[model samples]
Target: MNPKVSIIIPFYNCPYVDQAIESAINQTYPNIEIIVVDDGSTEFKEKLAPFQENIVYIRKENGGTATALNEGIRSATGEYIAWLSADDYFLPNKVAKQISFMMRENVEASFTNYNYMDETSQPIDHWTRPVFSNNDDVYRAFLNYNAINGCTVIIKKEVFEQAGYFNPNLRYTQDYEMWVRLLIEGYKIYYLDEELTKFRIHKESGTYKHQQAMQQEISIVENEYKPLLKEYIARNLE
Candidate 1:
C-alpha cells in the first residue's frame, strides 16, 4: 500500500478556501486525508459548508496559522503531513510525485517548487524559487532568507515528534522558524524540482497584508537561528 499522506489546510476567512479543499480532495494520490482547520472564520463560513462532509473540519477560536496547523497536525493519522494554505491549491499529481521523490531519496522531509496564482485563480509567476545545488547551499541560503515554501512541503509525521511543532507565537514566520528548527534537529528538507503547488497571492492574503510585520518576524527568526546554522554548517557541511 502507498504511504498515507495527511494534507492539512489552515483556513481563515479567505474566500478561496473552497478551492484549497477541492484541490486536496482531487489529488491523484489515493491514500490521503484532508484536514481543514478553520481558524475562527466568520465571513466565508458558508463556503466551507458544501465540502464539510469531504474533510475533517475543526473550528477553533481565532489564534493564527501556526495554531491551526498544530491542531490539524495533532489530529492527523497519516504517516506524512502536507500543508496547503487556505488560499493555495495543489496540482492533481502533487502528492503522488512528491511522495515518490521522498521514498526514492529516503528523505523524511522535502519541499517542491511552486507557481503563483492570483485571487481569481489565474496563474502568475511560474516556479518562483531559486535552485540549490545541495543541502549545504540550502542551509546557507536560509541565513539570508527562507527558500522553502511551506505549502509545497511534505514531511514525515515522525519528524515532528522529534523536532516539535510550529511555534504558536510566530503568527507569520512560523513556517520559516519551523523549517530552521528542523534543520537544527538534523532533519534535512530535500528539494524536489517540481512545481506541484499553486500559491495564491491576494489583497487579503497575510503575505500581502503583513509585509512589514512578516519581515520583522523573519529577521528575528534569522537572528535566533543564524548562530546555530553557522555552527551546523561548520560542523557538518564541506
Candidate 2:
C-alpha cells in the first residue's frame, strides 16, 4: 500500500494562497492529502471558495505560523508530512519524487533543493545547497547554518512524534528550532539534489519584513543549541 502524505499549508492574508493550494492539489503523487490552515486572516472566506472542496480547510484565531502548522499536523491522518508555505508552491512531481527517494533510501526526513521566485512566481535563482557525505555531516552543517527549507521538507509523522512539534513561542525561527531538535535526537535528514519546490520572495514575506526579529530569534536558537552542537563536533573530531 502506498503511504499517505499530508501537505500542510499555513497562511495568513497572502493573495498567493490559491496558487499554493493549486500546486498541492495537482501533485502527481496519489494518496496525498492537502490541508490548509487559515491563521486568522482578515480576508474574506470567499477568497478560498474556489479550492474549498479540494482542500481540508481549518480556521482558527490569529496565531503564528508555528501554531498553525501544529494545528494542521494534529488534524493530519497521513503517515508523512510536507509543509508548503501559502506564498510558495511545489512542483507537479515533488511529492512523488520525494516519497520515492525516502522509501528507496529508507529515511524518515528529507528536503530538496528549491528555486527562489518572485511574487509573480518567476524564477530568480536556485539555491545550491552543500553536499554532505553522510548524515552526520548533514547535522553538523545545520549547526552552522540552516540548510533545510521547511517548504522543501517531507518528514515522517513519527519523526514529529519523537522530536515534538514546532516551537509555538518562536515567532521567527520556529522551523529552524524544530530542525535543530530533530538533528539532536539523531534523526537523519536526507537532501535530494532536485529542485522540486519554489519559494516566493516578496516584500511582504516575513523574512523580508521582520529581518531584525528573525536574526534575533536565530541568535537565541543558536545559543540554546550551542552546547549540543559543540558536543557533536567534539565527538566527530575524536
Candidate 3:
C-alpha cells in the first residue's frame, strides 16, 4: 500500500492561495490529504471558497507561519508531511516522485530543487542545488546558508516528533531553524535533483517585503547552530 502523504499549506492574506490549493488537489499521487491552515487572514479568504469542501481547513489567530504549520502538523493523520507555501505550488507529479524516491532510498526526509515563477505564474528561472557527494557537504552548506527549501521538503511525521516543530518565535527563519535542528539531531535530509516546486516571486511576497528582518533572523539562527553543525559534521561525516 502507498503511504498517505499530507500536504500542508499555511496561508495568510496571500491572493495566490487558490493556486496552491489547486496544485495540491491535482497531485498525481493517489493517497494524499490536503490541509490548508488559515493564519487569521484578513483578506483573500474568499479565494479558499472553492476548495473549502476539498481540504481540511483550520483557522487560527494571527500566528506566524511557524505556528500555522505546527497546527497543521499536529492535526495531520498521514504518515508523511509536505509543506506548500500559499504563494508557491507543486508540479503535478511532485508527491509521487518524491515519495517514491524516499521509499526506495529508505530516507525519512528529503528536499528537491525548484524553479521560480512570477505573480502571474510565468516561469522565471530554475534553481539547482549542488550535487553533494556526501552528508558533510550538505551539512556544511547549511552552516553558510539554507540549502533546502521548506516547500520542497517531504518529511516523515516522526522526524518532527524527534526534532520538534518549527520555532514560533522565529518570524522569518523558522524553516531554516527547523532544518538545522533536524541536522543537529542526526536526521539526514536527502536531496532529490528535480524542480518539483515553483516558488512565487512577487513584490508582496515575504522575501521581497522583509529583506532586512529576514537577514537579521538568518544571522541569529546561523550563529546559534553553526558550531553544533560543524562539530556534527566532523564527528560523523569526517
Candidate 4:
C-alpha cells in the first residue's frame, strides 16, 4: 500500500519559504499532502499566496516552531508525517525514495543523511554517514541528531503521535526533547544510509544560537527526560 505522507511546513517570517514550498509541491510521491502552517506573519504569510491552491495553508498566531508543528500535526491526514522547516528545503526524489525505504523495511520511522547548502545552494560539506550502534534507534539518535538532519526524517503517524505534540515551551531543542520522549514511549526508528534531504543552514533558521538557546533547552530536556534517560541525559555540572 502506498502510504500517504503529510509534509507539514512551519513557516515563520522567512524569504526562503517559497523555495521550500516548491520543493514540497513537486514531490515525486503523489500521495502526499502539503500542510503549510503560517505562523502569523503579514509579509511572509502572503508569500505563500502563489501556491495557495496547491498546498493546504493554515494561519495561526505567532507562538513558536513547536506550536506551529502541533498545528500541522493535528491537521495531518497521512500515514506518515514529515516536517520541513520553512527556511530549509528537500532534495528532489526525497519523498519518493524515503517512502519506498519505509515500506520495504516496515519500520516505524526513517531518516536520511543530508547535505548543507548556502543561499546560492553551494555545497557546505558532504556529511559522512555516522555509524550508529543502533541503526533503528531513532530516538537515541535525536539525543545527538548526527544520524540525520531533523528535516531528513519522515516519521510514522503512530510514532509521531506517541511522542506527542511538540513541546510548546521549548523554543530551541524541541526535536531532541520529543524524539527522546518517543523512545521512552517505545517507538522503533531507523535511518537510511542515503543522503536524500538537502538542509540549508541559513542565518534565519537552524539551531544557530546554540550557545544561548541550547543551554536553556538542555535544562528543559534534562528536567523532562532525565527521569527517563538519566544515563543518556545526565546533568554535567562541571
Candidate 5:
C-alpha cells in the first residue's frame, strides 16, 4: 500500500490560501490527507468554503504557526507528514517524487529545492539547497545557514515522536530549530535536487516581518546546539 502523507498547512490570514489548498489537492500522489489549520483568521472561512469538502479544516484561537502546526499534527493520520505554507504551493508531482525518494533511500526525512515566486505566483528565483551526505553534515550546515525549507520537507511521523514537535514559543525560526533537533537526534535528512515547490515572497510574509527576530533566534539555536554538534563531530572523527 502507498503510504499516507499528511500535508499540514498552517495559516493566519493569507489571502492566497486557496492557491495553497489547490496545490495540495492537485498532488499526483494518491494517498494524501490535507489538513488546514486556521490560526484565528477572521474572513478565510468563506474563502475556504469551496475546498472544505476536500480538506480537514480546523479553526483555533490566535496562536503562532508552531501551535497551529502542532494541532494539525495531532489530528493527522498519516505515515508521513509534510508542511505547506499558506502563501506557498507545491507542484503536482511534489508528494510523489518525495515519497519515492524516501522509500527508495529508506530515509525518514527529506527536503527539496524550491523556486522563489512573487505574490502573483510568477517565478523569480531558484533556491538550490546544499546536499548533505550524512546527518552530521546536516547539523553543521544548519548551524552555519538554514538549508532546509519547511514547505519543502516531507518527514516521517515517527521522526516527530523522536525529535518532538516545533517549539510553540519560537515565533521565528521554529522550523530551523526543529531541523537542528532532528539532526542532533540522528535523523538523516536527504536532499532532493528538484525544485518541486514554490515559495512566495511578499511583504506580509513572516520572513519579511520578523527578519531581525529570525536572526536572533537562529543565533540562540546555534549556540544551544554548538556543544552537542562538537561532541558528535569529535566522536565521529575518532
Candidate 6:
C-alpha cells in the first residue's frame, strides 16, 4: 500500500511561496497533504487568503524557519513526509518519482538533484544532488559537506519520530543538522539522479546568506555529531 505524503511548506511574505503552493496542489500524485506554516508574515496573510482550506494554513508568531517547520511536522497526518520552502517549487513528478524510488529501494530517506534559479525563475546554475547515492556515501558527504537540501528530501515519517524534528535552538542550518543526524544513525539513504526540485537564490533566502547562522551551524555539527563522526570514521577504514 502507498502511504499518503504530507508536504510541509514553511513560508514568510516571500512572493514566490504562492508559486510553491500552486505547484504542490497540482502534483500528479494526489495522495499528498499540503501543510503550510505562516511564520509570522505581515503581508502574506492576504496573499494566502485564497489558499486557506485548500492548504492547511497555520499562523504562528514570528519565529525562525526551524520552529515553523517543527510546527508543520507536528500537524502532518501522512505516513510519509517532505518539506519545501516558500521561495522554491517542485516538479509535477517530484513526489511520485522520488516516493517510488524510496519504496522500491526500501530506504528511509531520499533526495534528488536540484537547479538554482534566479528571482525571475530562470535557471542560473545546478547542483546535481547525487552526492550520496548510497548509505556509505551519505556519511562521507556529511563530514565533507551537506549535499541533500531539505527541499529535495522525501523521508519516511519514522525518520522524524526516531531521529526527531529540527532543533528548535537552531534558527538556521537546522536542515543540515537533521540530514547529518539521520545519516549518522545508519539510516538508509538513497539519492535519485533525477532533478525534481527547483531552489531559488535571492536576497531573502536564509541558507544562501553566509552569516552568523553559518558559524552557529558549524558549531552545531561539531557538538552534535562529535561521537557519530568518530564512529563513522572508524568504520570506514579498510
lDDT of 4 by residue, 63-160 (tens): 98899988998989998999998877887799999989888987777777777788777878855556455554544555554234678889877765
TM-score of each: 0.97, 0.95, 0.97, 0.87, 0.94, 0.92
Task: Choose the strongest candidate by lDDT.
Answer: 3
Error of 1 at 110 (Å): 0.5
Clash count for candidate 3 is 0
Q: For candidate 2, lDDT tens digit of each residue in 11-77?
A: 8988898889899999999899999999999874566899867899999998799999999999999
Q: In each prediction, how many residue pairs overlap at the backbone (N, C-alpha, C within less than 3 A)?
A: 0, 0, 0, 0, 0, 0
Give the winner by lDDT: 3 or 5. Answer: 3
Q: How far is candidate 3 from the true structure (C-alpha RMSD, Å)?
A: 1.3
Please write out the lDDT profile of model 5 over residues 1-238, one tens digit for every residue. 5899999999788899999999999999999999999999986667788997899989899779999999999899999999999999999999999999999988988998888899888878554446666555665676478779899999998778767899998887889888877776667778888889999989999899999988898888888986786676567633
What do the candidate models score in CA lDDT, each in turn? 0.91, 0.88, 0.92, 0.77, 0.87, 0.82
Residue 184 error, candidate 4, Å = 2.2
Off by over 4 Å in 2: 126-133, 236-238
Q: State the lDDT of candidate 3 residue by residue for 1-238, as single tens digits.
A: 6899999999999999999999999999999999999999999999999887889999999989999999999999999999999999999999999999999999999998888889899988564445666556778898788888899999999889877999999988899999998999989999888889999889998889999999999989988999998998889877
Candidate 6: segments with Cα more than 4 A from true spot = 126-133, 236-238
What's the distance in Å from true for residue 155, model 2?
Answer: 0.6
Order of candidate numbers by lDDT, starting with the best: 3, 1, 2, 5, 6, 4
lDDT of 2 at 85: 95
